[model samples]
Target: MKTVICLVHGAGHQPLHYKYLIDALRRHGLTVAAPPLPTSGYDDASATKTHLEDVARVREYLVPFLEQGYEAILVGHSYGGRIITQAAAGLTGEERAAAGQDGGVVALVYIAAFTEKEQPLTPEILGVPPEDVNPATKLLWPEAAIRAMYHDIEPGRANEAVALLQRQSPRDLDGAAVCKSSDVPVPKRYVACRQDRVISFGTQLQFAEAAVAKVVAELESGHSPWLRDDGIRAIVDCVLEFSRRRQDDV
Candidate 1:
């Protein structure tokens, strides 16, 4: 059975934003599952949803694939790290095998995402005042988003990405911190964005350290690393490397 990479988008982002990276992975003969979070919708109910709801949604989406005997690698970006961490619990290959299932989550990949097991992701954690960053009440300001998320991206593409930004739930940000990666029972990898203004390089290191991730990649890019060609290649390389490791183990 082919391994599937379930790519979870960050806060304020939809799966469409990951098209380039997803396409590149597919071109390499890899199966990819990029699902949009419910919190990324523009509806009022979406704005009110929490991170746990997003986790539930992702877990539900993976059921059919798992039932078909396909192993999965949960790949999270930005706030998605929290979602994957929670969703992968009790879904490990070993755990599923014990239950007479042949397929389950085998690994986790975080792309400049939040992984702190203790710190709840709130505006305060993001270093912004609550009044300035209310996702439930307003959408991301395009120019500011470009400056923080796409600084290293080309101007045109950055603008386009900003335009695709959706309203994310503020309540999701207040969701409780996830369990430690050690508790998840799967190998973990983290891709650190050095030039990231939102999630700084130092913070990425801290999160990786806290999670005790087995692999870490340092990239000189902004928050959205996939916006650049080299960044996309690097991510694909990382995913492929993980696949190779899984094969070797098998």
Candidate 2:
């Protein structure tokens, strides 16, 4: 069966934002499953659903693939890292196979994303200094963050990216995700965005270290690494490399 990449989107942004990456992966003969988080709706002033809700949303997409005997690769971008970590909790090949189940999550890929830690991951935690940050933290489109988040992308794509930016909840960032890094004992890799403003290079290293991540791939893009010309392919290539190791180990 083909490897299916289950994409967990970032906060505020919907799955559609992953269209470019998804299409590229598909063209390479890979399957992609990108879902919009429940918290991604616009004008959702009262969106109180936590990261667990987002986890459940991802599981909904993965379970179907597992049922059909296909390996699912959980790939999270930015805040999607929190959701994928929680969603993948207790769901691994060894555990599932031991329980007489099959086709579990094989690996994790974090693209400029968060990792398991005691405290909830916030912008401050990821190296965005709190000096001039917002209290509500509800960032509007085309904000200064874009300058840092997508600095490397072509200037023409700015408006398109701005249009996709939505209001992410501070509660979600401040609240701890449901799962721990140790909870999901699977081979993983961290695709660090070298020039990421949202999560600095040093901060990304910190998260990877905390998770004890097996591999790390550095990209020369901004916070949103997928915008780089070779961004999505590099990620898929890294996953394939991990997959090879997984097969060899077994």
* Tens-digit lDDT string for candidate 1 (32-95): 8887898877667786888778888898888788989888988899889988988888888888
Candidate 1 — number of clashing residue pairs? 0
Tens-place lDDT digits, model 2, residues 111-159? 8888763535554655555543445535533556566576677766655
* Cα TM-score per model: 0.92, 0.88
Q: Which structure among the candidates has the greatest TM-score?
A: 1
Highest lDDT against the true fold, candidate: 1
Candidate 1 weakest ten by summed lDDT: 128-137
Q: What is every candidate's alpha-carbon RMSD to the true fold? A: 2.0, 2.6
Poorest stretch of ten by lDDT in candidate 2? 132-141
Tell me the spans in candidate 2 whose CA falls farther than 4 Å from its real position: 117-137, 173-176, 243-250
**What is the C-alpha local distance difference test score of each model?**
0.81, 0.74
